[model samples]
Target chain A: MFDVLTRILRTGICSEPLPRIETEQAANLQQRIWAVLGRALCIRQVDAGSCNGCELELHALNNPYYNLEGAGIKFVASPRHADLLLVTGPVSVNMEEALLRAYEAVPHPKLVVALGDCAACGGIFGESYATRGGVSRVLPVDRVVNGCPPAPPDILRAILEAAQGKRQALAAATAT
Target chain B: MAEFNATPDFSGAFANAGALPSNVPCRLIETSREQWLRVAEALRAAEGMLLALWGHDERDGGQGFLVYASYLTAQGLLVARLCLRNGDERFPSLARLFPCAVRMERALHDLLGVASDQDDERGWLRHFGWPREFFPLRGENRLQTSFPPTPEPYPFVSVEGEGVHEIAVGPIHAGIIEPGHFRFSVVGEKVLRLEERLGYTHKGAAKRFQTLSLAAGHRLAARLCGDSSVAYAWAYCAALEALSATVVPPRALWLRALALEHERLANHLGDLGALGNDAGFAVGLTQFSRLKEDLLRLNQAALGARYLFNFVQPGGVECDLDPKWATDLPRFYSHLDTELEQMRSIYDEHAGLQDRFRGAGVLSTATARRLGALGLAARASAIPLDLRVDYAIAPYDRMRTKIVTQDAGDVAARVVVRFQECLEAMRLCQRLLEQLPSGDIHSAPRVAPSGALATGIIEGWRGPVMVALQAGPSQSIRHCHVHDPSWQNWPLLEYAILGNIVPDFPLINKSFNLAYSGQDG
Candidate 1:
């Protein structure tokens, strides 16, 4: 009865942003709170030639757990409308040309976020003849989020950071 | 052997299509451009779709290189081989006959520096970043150099109108995803055209196959696309097994089907969650994602790899379902059923999800068939070609499946098919577990008999994955091609996104869910 009542209460409360706020506070610092709450961002995604593991996590951002739009960020289908380009995969041979073309297509004032180890410097799949090691080889990267395919929460945090433009500074200043 | 009497007289049928001279028995048809059209027409009469088209450097007594085309028929396989001498690279383009032929020709041009009058000048598969004139697959030019130089400006087509600004997304995405370029010509909220440029995930796995032993080759297949490892491995093994004529044990066959369906279920679960989230339905996403995670955990526990790598080897399976899987499967099914019902309600009752999914990214049956869309997308759009059904392979044939379909071929129909297939898969898993047979898990696969060729097709989670293997001068892999259905459907994604609002592209893309890694290879 308590679980049922809690679920009903929770579902109702979800519409008001409290549950998401509760979850967001745990993952982000108090200073970063306004970063997520204040802005709705359009994301542009790039893939050098990833294994699609990162895609799985990217797909998760839209799921109820991360509900990025609920947090005020949206994934715009094209780069011209995008505020950020999220990159996954190590750049591969066939994709090198296409990747650069896509980067050039996006409008100015756009932020670039590298989403995985492959994007950073050629994760496990880097050594193959098909890849060029990392996405940075193909395009400029402003922020790096490391993981095989970072968890949905981590991706959401990266987007939030891009939206706020605050968390990357912390990582850089801390020198971690 | 009386089997010798069954061989058809190629002189009468393919003689006009460039049947080679008597001395060149190893070489088949050297089809001319005019002959390619005739050959395609003839093969169409035999009911075969053009599987793939690509070039290989000349080897052994074989001259310059060969361009190959494959046709599938109920009786057996038919291959049309066109030899392209190094300097004389011109060949008739089959793109006019088969729409999917355009991209294959472009890939040939990009990789081998080979061109044909049939080439699609739209640059469907050309490199935008790499040196423009330098072809990667030409054997003499294997060295990586910075000089050939990428094209200075990519020439993607744009739409011009008031409020029509172009939006380009990716080669690099913010999320952990494979690289592909999505160019949207949009007017405020409305999308006029969506052009997708992929092939960033190309690993040259097909080219590397020549160096790999059959055992190691399976590893390469599994890595072609990570998520569909089992399907790729199975397809590769199937080609090798058919070439070798190895008879796999029945129990192993059943288990293979079970694993394939399990793979299908895992992807569908994850997709369902994502699709829901695309609709702005958080509750559905949360529930389905939790469900998908549970399924992944189950996969990790059952197979050493969550994606079921190396579990499938040529001739038989590498691992058996543990005793725990048999026991735990029922409970898992029940859990899945409960969660599925919950999701169904959310999808059914929710108004927003319907608005996003109903008619968005619609790919009609005609368009899907014309584009050669394979797998569930094709099936959902009413293209009744399931390898398990059409080919009637073991386990799938015996354990009948009511093919799930929806003619709408829109995003909603895809979701409906996916959701329905999930339920059916769960039921099938339950049945397979109950009817589990007792037998050895592995079998000794056959070594190829000399001068044999075979093709294997498996309906992977994504679509029909076809792998063709031909035995070379010494029973080695002479030439091979791995065909992902993405080859057919990725082009269709451009059409599906047309007229959809820009914001709906993700929902549309996720609905088709083609793989860049597999297709690029």
Candidate 2:
């Protein structure tokens, strides 16, 4: 215990602050979110058909560097308790119905964030004999963070923006 | 040709038992339907491991359904192909002899409409969403079709007794993990039995492979399991190069080895940290996760992607290692070694953590062998089988790779094996960086002729990942089967969970860390 404590003291505060949102609108929207929820956000993640790559990055959000929970955004076990649904992968046919059920289970005004390229635009594994294209093809996605597997900061930003209800604006900005 | 030693007279059953296409290490034996079971039995008797079993539709020609099984032996690999004539879809099931053949046979039944004599006829890979009549991978139903949203409760096996209850978890799990259902039959937290139902992430990767060009197939292969992207891409490229009869540059082989080692290091670090966290040590999680992030950031800087996807292409790697990476990697390893040593000591000194880890999930060697467990899981059980050492292809053949094994077959054993492997991978990366040859990183591969078939087997971080490719006319892929070691290791998870408390399942499962997407694909 003494060793652990000394090690901690030596390491000092290695915890980095959450990354800043670049866009002014998204930053303003995150401030509005702070006003409404006061930094507490419960998220539930659903894997529609991902390759587990996105899940790896999502798990990294909990690391000391990103420390998503430190920002008061926690991933809950059940959809019923969540305020946001962070969906990944290109909705596989097998998981489409389950994704829908999860979306419906969440309370009203729940924000849905589509993560990774697969969830955004189907990525490489497009609508096929086994998939129903992207997450938008099945459920309404408020925010889309695009990357094969988006970096943790990008995912965190998208979650914050979605909580602020700036998904449409964020999408419009990315479009331009 | 090596003389036939142990068999039920191969000369009578096979039309041709010699001369496989380029790059396939196995000898192709075309067999009649009657001779299929006898050959499979003889091979199993000789202790040959059933590597893969897949089906192909040859109805366009006069032949009906073609089924092939590849077996790995000490001598080498042997592939047996059985042809079922028109109107005959059933074949003798090898699952009765080799228990691992059950899932693969079921997959063939789902994709190509082939029937195994001993099959339960229940849906395996094909979920309720897919129509029963439509066989997706067959030539006739190759095109995309709209699937109806049919949500059916899977028929999980039930255990009935006084106070014997069943706990069902997932398709969607609590933590940020892949989707798979686990049905545990427990008597007050002591697990009686555990059954895993996967395939929630099946994305028609095999069917999609048929639509892609040989070059594009590598991208799809890399995505088959994202964590082992480099291994899968290398295997795909190896298969393509073999089909095209193209030899990758020496420098390319060394670079590929370096990337593979980095992947191994990153995954092992992540798993070690997760295991520590599961044992109630958050310090391990924080430290290891930070280290993993640093490694990923290094990968992004050097390879252009955090996961190193699409960095390995046909005939060689897609890009050369940056000179900066060459300088930074050795320095990074030196720093990592010191920190990792301190962390290891901390973990060792923690009595509570050791108690949680030592004997939690014990998979005996007998059980692991019976279930055909592969990769780190197998190594933990003292099954000394590693493709890099046994198969020894390209750079691995030259490197003095050390095979690590632990006899305990428990969570502690798995942890130790992972630590040893991570250290070895670090040493390997340093070696590859220092001894990298001077040459081209890529060579433009020639187009493979139609009907060409090749196989690539790489010892990925998890285990031996196998890719078998058959080229169509005009350089398109006719079929590509990407097999992950998870297929062999997943069954062992059920056995590992037995008698352990429900809470420790995550820790045990993370120790194995089988890829759901790879298996579902």
Candidate 3:
């Protein structure tokens, strides 16, 4: 609930009277902040063994139109330098232990966002003889961006949400 | 014929290798379960590479479970089916010959409740949180949650040294990638050895397929590996048609080829961009990504799905090409020509990318052959194992093809192979489109027999995709294993990452771009 409230505040949803900065940012400065954050993020992606659909869209994120790097976000090669984990595929029996180890490899204060329905719910590989059906089965999932393979922008939104720490389910909320 | 586009020849290679007997009626030959070790040795001596090992638990009468070892020889493919009687379900392990066979054996044990008497003590496919002894692939009635207690940390091989530091990375990573664990034995930044622990996403796709109809199973096949949707669908349908002795109309075959070429082009474009990004060429990333997007948009216009899902069915394709795009392809071809040339120049000019990609992650021809590396990895390294030329499948048999090869056997070589294939695929697509005949898109296939089994192999972008289907009593699928080339490559990746610095691992990995779900399935 608190996180929800925070998100609302971040979006300037609850500021009825509206602070000057909030209104201005909400009205016309969204792109400015996005541009700033875009250049600042360095992303890392994990396949866990997906069919390459989500990775395709993730590839599309770098297309001239979205120009993910122009926004300032770059796809890093190693988890050591990464801020987020982009996981695709339904977790499989062969990959479960590997997934956990990779999660532990990333430094502290890292984010994990499951991309596509397979990573979110195992998608079509669900109930198969060889898979666990979702990324959450192997690790504590932070946010799930669902689609067969989610559109690139939706993936960007999920990453943005994680960067802002909105995907964290707080202890207070859990305790309540 | 263009020298660059000239295909390689593999005639009489298998026969010369003596992998197959002079006369074998069926594609498969039966042998006792106990002969597995002897068969492995014999096949190895005969120059046959182990393709895959699959387990089936349908006890015919009291005859017990059947396990199959698929071997690819120079002449023709051969399968050795080993039958284990009901009470004795143990088989000798083949890990000694093929180091990768260990995991496939464990997968069979985990899914079918069978065990290898010679299996290494380390637990494999069962490491996922699934209940022990549940054996999800078995026809036995039981819930997945009701199996025995979970085992503690599985025993993985350990390396020890004074300067060797152990760097463990992911089943969940810090990137938008698949979950996999790699234990890197490193000194400073140089990696000595890398061991992978996967199976985090082990949904029982092969097992669940039993409940689906042939039509429904086609959908499952397409979903087996999302990026290789067309490949899986075609492979599965090909198996179905072959089993039913049904012939697909010429137009459907033409359409299937078209879908495949597009699929290949889309993936090559996307992977090229990712590879460029890995090498720190942001320009390459932007340019190639844009090109891929345009291609996918064209796909969306041609087929309903940008990824081309639900496009290929059992008998043929789900739909036909829009006449406009069919007519407008020349313009698309023009755009691709310009973009590819530009991208090629960027790659050629970028020294950093070349430095990182060229010598790094070199899987030599000897090692590649030992592991039976498939697809571009094999071709780029001079293994010369393309199914298009060797197996001579439908449209490919009728049409001319150039198998792109490079002897570098490194990241750069793999990238070069993909880029070159992009041009070849475009040419093939044009040939297919121009030659499409007028005919029905599909045909009603003959229903399968209860105990019958069939398999199909298609040359997907990643490499050879194999699908095995077994029919149950009610004509439902008994078991289906949608084997992706990743299974063969992931183990090789573990070896490829060795001797390179830890930081360069991602670029080496992206260069191959093996499918995660394909392996997980």
Q: Indicate which candidate wins on lDDT.
A: 2
Cα-based TM-score, every candidate:
0.79, 0.95, 0.82
Candidate 1 residues lying further than 4 Å off, grouped into runs, are A1-46, A57-88, A93-130, A134-176, B1-35, B45-47, B72-77, B122-124, B143-149, B158-165, B449-452, B471-476
Error (Å) of candidate 3 at residue A51 is 4.1
Give the per-residue Cα lDDT of candidate 3 at B48.
Answer: 73
Model 1 lDDT, full chain set: 0.70
Candidate 3's C-alpha lDDT?
Answer: 0.71
lDDT tens digits by residue: candidate 1, B1-521:
01112224333333323222110111235454455566677666554666667677664445876777765444333457677664677777877767888888888777777776863465544455455566656665543333333444557887887888988877665444566778888888888888777766776555567656665577677766877888888888887877776777877877888888888998998888778877887556666776776676577687655567678887788788888888887898897897687667668766778888898888888888677777788888887766667666667766677688899889999999999989988887887888878898777876786545566778787777877776665556766678888888888888888888877888898898888888888
User: What tens-digit string does per-residue lDDT give for candidate 3 at B100-196?
Assistant: 6777887788778778766465556567356665677766743233222254776567778888778887765555665567788899999988888
**Number of colliding residue pairs in each model:** 24, 0, 74
- Give a tens-digit lDDT track for model 3, residues A46-133: 7765766777788677666665665446788776776677777776556555556567777765678888988898776663435566
What's the TM-score of chain B for every model shown? 0.89, 0.96, 0.92
lDDT of each: 0.70, 0.84, 0.71
| Model 1 Cα shift for residue A70 (angstroms) | 14
- DockQ of candidate 1, scored on C-alphas against the true complex (2 decimals): 0.29
Judge candidate 1 at residue B129 and give its lDDT. 43
Where's the lowest-lDDT run of ten residues in candidate 1 chain A?
Answer: A13-22
Tens digit per residue, CA lDDT, model 2, B41-65 = 7666776677789988888877888
- In model 2, what are the clashing residue pairs, if there are any? none
The DockQ of predicted model 3 stands at 0.30
What is candidate 2's local distance difference test score?
A: 0.84
